[model samples]
Target: MLFFLPDAAAAVRAYARLLRPGGRLVLSTFTEVTDADKEWFQHLGAALGPYLPASPEPAPGSPPPPEARLRTQQSLADVLTDGGFSDLRFAEIAHRTVFARPEQFWDWLWSAGMRGMMESIAPQDHDAVRTALTALVAERLRAADGTLGWTTSIRFTTARRP
Candidate 1:
């Protein structure tokens, strides 16, 4: 929702207006995909079918979301500044989550964009995709304790209204 704003700067200004003077605004978001995670997903997609797309295409006449553009420190700072927020600060956080069972990972995947991909596949192909992904995670991404671990980059931003 942070992205695809008609005027992201103006939206920021509107957010600033909602806060009392000297109030602080804090926002956190997933920023970039780690290379390992990207590669893992690529492998999963390849195994799924003819390379299932990560996200669906935008509707006709819809503007593309600024997912990559606003991910950097500079871009976030610029937005806060344009919104008239002061004392801006930024932080990058490394986050990790582990799933003890392969089914847990599968459940997590189906909760989001991957659900669409899974539904698009034929019934026969579904089992093969699931088996391949499960094995891939266990073999390549799982920890010694039989848990699958994943890391991602997150950005935390704070700014104060002047």
Candidate 2:
């Protein structure tokens, strides 16, 4: 099942309450936000000036979110154990999702997490944002064939309820 739990330990404890003894729980989440992702947000912030305080990417040296902490094998295992889970296992899934056209990328940006930011942008600035975003995306992700590529790193964590 997909979970948006931000507190790894709380997530583990909650899962433990739901699962019967010896039941298994498997979940996947991102471990880190790459520099390219930060760049994308930075570009977006620039386009929507004064609308956003900062990029979505957490500031450097700040405490990482729970998902980031769970990226560490030891941290995940420890949390699971403390929450009554045993036999924890982890695996990494790396992949690239390509948008065949810029429109597809824009569609995803609007439909996915970036939707919230869209509401904050003034209607008049939409075109400008799009134009700037297109250039930014083209600079970083445009491929020889014209598709835009996004690489993702996901961690799949599996554990058995003790």
TM-score (C-alpha, index-matched) for candidate 2: 0.75
lDDT of 1 by residue, 1-162 (tens): 565567778888998999999999888766766688678778776767553545677799775465555777777888889889989887888877787866566777778545766777677666676777778777777767666877677788889999
Candidate that scores best on TM-score = 1
Q: For each candidate in turn, give its C-alpha RMSD to the true structure in angstroms.
A: 3.4, 3.9
Q: For residue 139, give model 1's deviation from the true position in Å.
A: 2.1
TM-score of 1: 0.77
Off by over 4 Å in 2: 1-7, 35-69, 144-146
1-162 per-residue lDDT for model 2 (tens digits): 223455667868988999998899997766566787788667766756754445587688766644345556676778789988888788888878797766566667788656876777777777777777677667778768777987678889899987
Whole-structure CA lDDT of model 1: 0.75
Off by over 4 Å in 1: 4-6, 49-66, 113-119, 122-124, 144-146
Model 1 CA lDDT for position 31: 79
